[model samples]
Target: MAAEPVRIDDPADPRIAGFVSIRERDLTGREGLFIAEGTVVLRMLGQAQARANGFAAEAILLLESRLAGIAEVLAAFPPEVPVYIASQAVFDAIAGFNMHRGVLALGRKPSAQVGASLLGRLPGTSLVLAGCGLSNHDNVGSIFRNAAAFGADAVFLDETSCDPLYRKAIRVSVGSVLTVPFSRAMAGEAMLRGLAEAGFEIWGLSPRGQVSVAAIPPARRIALVLGTEGEGLPEHILASFRTARIPQRPGLDSLNVATASGIALYQIALAMGRVA
Candidate 1:
């Protein structure tokens, strides 16, 4: 396949608009598009491409000199996807940061059905469902990555949680975001009820909780409930299920949500003999 590269000299070129103000509200808020940086993430995105599921690659931006190599990497993509080449300086200007590897791509958000169906298929599964106030994308991504790596069956995000596909979350997950199945729960109450109805024993992770996480018995299916950094789970939500906390040192307040998730997931996996 011949590599066709379009030279973009002007930063303001309307064709490259997706690459602008990625950190600001213009692109994220208005268009709901987030930027993914580095070659590894871009490659992950390419590998996870699905045809029937609204997978659309808008553009690929690369350094002028690296165009050939990038073209080779992108050879799998159809001809309709635009490939843009720019000088390192121009690429930096457009990306609003140093172009780490001179490669980036614009991808559409997968539909909510993708997540919903992914969760529904896994019956009697142990998983993580992030609740309200956990807004950090990196933390959310890390939790997802750990969930997948540690053998958690799926993930569910509450209404207040950040988008798992957000660029920062995706990058932090090291692209594990694509591998892990996830869905959104409109309210914390609904999430808890659904998991209970699905026959999962819900375990809430909190610092002040009475029972240690290790005490929770291994079950056929479990749902680990994780809340935000400072506020923890609301009273009503806490009252809805059994609460468990990671044992910690005398002075330390608590573990970060992601770290707490990893420990809890490891324990569950170990109990099931899934981890050696």
Candidate 2:
């Protein structure tokens, strides 16, 4: 079992600095660290840590009242990971709000994997998602959640996509961001090139797509590319790759990127027999 929880009555404690003013410091504080909030996300972090899947908990700050209910999830962490408890008042003070979920973890992101390296790791018969210029956190998170639901083997985000590790994204994903393997930081064109070179049959999603996503021709590997919500996929990308549409009703320009991703992933996954 993990060690007993340490109590931190003071909100200013340096040991818990990573948890302070969390919302305001999201992009700045804790260099490469992220806050995993709620019981579900924390449990995923614990599983990753236990499996040595590249992410680990640095410390967890819990509301004192939540201890009994959360004990089993906390036990999944190794003993070396510290667990701290604070009264509701102190927890609220440190978090800069009332953290009703009452569980938070300071997690370290894995070492960066090069985009090409991530692509190379996919299985020969893989189904993956490739995102370009997807700047919305909720969209990215929902995409990841959809990926996990549909049995996508991995996800790749281009340079302009927002970090999926962002607090809101991770939470919105219901922690699927932790479970799904992903890579980011490549230029949009380079990312597509890498996928193509890796033997993936690339299909970009668009309202004007010539083929329906479900009717996509069989391929050993598939990469479904999604773009940011409003502009949809770039014109050049559409022209360069085989593009597919969801067959939406006319006059409706398009679906939300996240929602579009789910429909596309589900249809593709069904075709590939990746999902029942």
Candidate 3:
């Protein structure tokens, strides 16, 4: 069983400091720490911790009323991980918002090398998502949700891509950001080059791609590169790699980058026999 939830009536309790003003700290530049809200995400964090995926819950703050419902999830964390409970007013005060979900957690990211090491260890036959200049957290989160849905082996974000661990991004992903193995912080060109060198058949996604996504032949390792919205893929990137387009109606310019990623990843995953 998880340890009994510690009752904290004070919003300024130093132990719960991480839970204060959560909205302002969503960027989580605090040495790889992040806030996880809602039962679903807390559950995913538990799974990541259980699997030793290099993530762990440092503490959890919840409204006293939510204690019973989330007890199962709290049990997943080690007893040493503090679980703080507060009255609704105190919880709201600590979170700096209404906190309708009545749940919040402080989670620490894995080691820095976790993402960088994914490439060298992927199996010979695999499919991965390569993102370039994906500046939107919602899109990044959606891409991860899709990556997990389609069984993409991993996700690689170029230096310009937003951190998938950002608060809104993680929430938008419904915790898929924790579930999916991903690496970020490298130049666009170099990220793709590393994939190419790793034997991946890099395919860029664009509204004006050279071929239909279905036409792209199957390969042992495929890297589907998605770009930012509005501008789409960089000119240099489109020029350098094979590209695929999702056929669409005449009026619309293109699907949202996140939506497009789902369709493209589904096609590639299906072609690779990863999805039925």
Candidate 4:
């Protein structure tokens, strides 16, 4: 059965109530959902249907000009999922930005349990722990994409990290965030203890380090901890974990957190014999 397409010109349409971010309304308690934009992301969403089963998805919103092509893809969805169409101007106004690809979709948020169980399933090797307050969605997305491409087992975020499922993060990750298994650590001391109990050797990435990243010993299980830009890791967390540094030409300040994460993830993967 073909998915129904709904056409709307008004930005105030109630059907898209969740798409609009209202500041006055506190959404902190609301169950979080993921918004994905662009055809690339939509396609990935369709491909990941099995993993995303519990997560409900909104209809694909597209410009009328792109309706026909998008319809072919929407056919993969159940008939109950609507496909919304709007004029380019109306789409831009409703989306609050120039949606160059004229496509957006909302996916149901994964439960914390789903993320927590990931650690038990990972083949003992290396993982990337996002410890910083990565408030930037783009950076969070890029980190997940890199973690997936570099063969990292899982991506773990500290309590202060950004929402990986945010629209910007999903778009930047090209939807790879949906496929990557991740969980949030409770907080400082507990997070460290949980990792230790899990048999993961936590290695903090910082400029002031006793060992170079290249010198990290091959371990059965490893977790690479990354800090936010500018602030870096907290001194307490630094004191808690063994530290490692990336070798660079003197005078260079530091690599962007995402770039540093990619290099570190790749190196760890290689060292653990998980990747070439």
Among all candidates shown, the one with the greatest lDDT:
3
**Backbone collision count in every prediction?**
0, 0, 0, 0
Error in Å for residue 107 of model 3: 0.5
1-276 per-residue lDDT for model 1 (tens digits): 323779999889999998876666432554435556667777666666643344456788888877766655677566777889899889889878786678778876666677667556786546555556678888998998898788887788888887877777888998777666677746777877887888888888888776888887888888888888878888887887899988888665678889988998888788777789
Poorest 10 consecutive residues by lDDT, candidate 1: 25-34
How does each model score on TM-score?
Answer: 0.88, 0.97, 0.97, 0.88
Task: Flag the better candidate by lDDT, 2 or 3.
Answer: 3
| TM-score, candidate number 3 | 0.97
Residue pair clashes in candidate 3: none
Runs of candidate 1 with Cα error greater than 4 angstroms are 1-3, 26-32, 50-55, 68-72
Residues forming the 10-long window of minimal summed lDDT in candidate 2: 113-122
In order, what lDDT does every prediction score? Answer: 0.76, 0.90, 0.91, 0.76
User: Taking the tens digit of each residue's C-alpha lDDT, what string does model 2 give over 1-276?
Assistant: 677899998999999988999998996645779989999999999988888768999999999998999899999998888899999999999999889999999999887863346777778899999999999999999999999999998999998999999999999999998888899888888889888998999999998899898898768899999999989889989989999999878885678989999999989888888878
Which residue segments of model 4 deviate by more than 4 Å?
21-30
Model 4 lDDT tens row, 192-246:
6777788999998988877889999889888888888878888988898899988
Consecutive 10-residue window with the lowest summed lDDT within model 4: 21-30
Order of candidate numbers by lDDT, starting with the best: 3, 2, 1, 4
Clashing pairs in 4: none
